[model samples]
Target: MHVTWGRNIGTTVQSEEDLYFSANSENWFDMSSLGAFDTYTSDNDWVSVEKMVPPVETDDMITTRDVSKLCEDISSLYLNEKFSDVILVLDGEKLHAHKAILARCEYLEALINDGSQHLQQSEIAITDVSPEAFKKLLKFIYTVSTITITSNVGLIVEVLELARQYCFKDLENATIQTLKSALNLKNICSTLNIANLYDLSDLKQACHTFVDQNALEIVTGDGFTDLSQKSVIQLLERDTLLVPEIEIFKSVSKCKLNDDDDNLVIGSVRLSWLTVEDIVSTVWPSKLVEDEKLLGAIVEIVEVKAKTSVCRAKKCMKNNHNWRKIDL
Candidate 1:
């Protein structure tokens, strides 16, 4: 806020900048620059505005405690169909709700009130979501709280999917955060798969970062093999993957043995980074030999080895360094 003091004598200006954007009008501003202090009054001869102080905040404490009971009462009314106007047929189970559910949820509002035939009957069918997960969603919508998602990865995944499908962005974000807390090496791949499939950008980044930072252990784990071909390709493509290229190729080979994927590219790996002996004895003579994609990589390795030999012959070269041996 830029506050400019007027130079004119006997002029007073009282002002309040709504920096916080609070609804209260009681903002106190000392206006001594205009004139000498006098009794506070709503007079214009001077900057006669009275100081406004916001009322005390006692209501918030009360409301926070009262909202739970209010939610329970409203939920009771909904279940008893006291004023319910709609029924959700979730996997053959009837769930009662008011028209407000449509108002609160985007997909429900679109499906129920946007000229669907089901609107007339006040009944909508949800065939994909399980009844229990649907119930958990309703509880959150009605109570303004999320169900416990800790150590309940499956339930969290289901709810997270529902949140995304229904366009509940706040709930989707909350579920993603919950999923982040639950993530570990064991379930990282599965969570990453869901994040990718559901297009959860933040969660996807989190999973990718976790795997990239722990690439060594992760690549050796069972979860790495369980990853979708797309996930594996993405992991391999990241320059941030810190595991040795040799281990990565081993894991990729294992994955290839179980499921044939044409999209798995080996170019991301600096094949030259593998020692020449290792390449000749292990990499080339083994599984890498049959793969056509590695043909160029194998050639690159040989070229690097030749360069290293020349550098060694030059003697001035430090450790016969081959620039191609460096991996990004």
Candidate 2:
């Protein structure tokens, strides 16, 4: 019998009566045990067999059993003054750190390098990030223990800001994922504002989806009007925002922080979807839109609705006539 095998696989030929093969330097298998073939070829004839073996596993397998312990060991070094090469001052407190690990962050690397091969000083000051937030950042850098990141929305937002500010991509991604999972009505607006301000597209899109799903409660809820003009416009532009045009108009009217914002937000609302009375009473009083534009929009909307009503009635009447004409 002849055997064809995949590249890099070992093969050895022996007596055809009971063939044995070893795919590696050690383990060997009998052909009979593998049940690879039912019939044997004659001495004058040749049969072909092909086999491929996957890479072998050994006793010395790579394991992460010590990874967590290693992380914990490194975490103990965090904020410890011993063997510390640098100090970060923030939130009226000093943080101990190693320059080698701090270089993992682009912003911190720049600060440490300071246009030279090494740090100009052992101390760096940061005023924007709070001590609790900076400590969380350091914890993640040392241990990568995401579980310790607080579930509180406010703290998570602070962590997200520090992560972004320091250009810690892993910490930033992890924080955004946490925020995405933590999104709710009470905090969506504030979280969305941060997402928009920093142009964090993934987190921004998550916020948009959450808002779209909880459109009614979110739009009518407190803090809705405090959204940035751009965020308001994004919400108004969605066709799936299942809220009455009147309520949306009310929200948009309240969103007016300035003339430009007012015009943009008002334009985004589908005024034609509102009733004539709604436009006159609610929208007209606000005067967000000009008299001529609002009047024209209302007139056009009323005409379209009237035409639609007449067509529907005519269709019903025709269907009735057909029913009556048919023999029962």
Candidate with best lDDT:
2
Stretches of candidate 2 off by over 4 Å are 1-61, 113-124, 147-152, 306-328
What is candidate 1's lDDT per residue for 144-262, written digit by digit as tens?
Answer: 57557566688888887788778887778777888887788888989998887777788889998787556678987777777777777777766666566667766666664332463
lDDT of 2 by residue, 1-328 (tens): 4454443343533335434356443445545555545454445444445333445667876558767676678878878898899888886688889987777778887888885634677778877667788888888887786734344788887888888778788998898888888888888998898888888899999998788678889998987988998888777776656566778888777774788778788898776667788877888888788899888878877777732111000112464562212110
Worst-scoring 10-residue span by lDDT in model 2: 307-316
Error of 1 at 86 (Å): 3.0
**C-alpha lDDT score of every prediction, in listed order:** 0.64, 0.72
Q: Model 1: runs farther than 4 Å from truth?
A: 1-27, 30-82, 114-116, 119-123, 256-263, 289-328
Whole-structure CA lDDT of model 1? 0.64
In model 1, the Cα lDDT at residue 55 comes to 50
Residue 298 in candidate 2, Cα distance off native in Å:
2.5
* Model 2 Cα RMSD, 1 decimal: 8.9
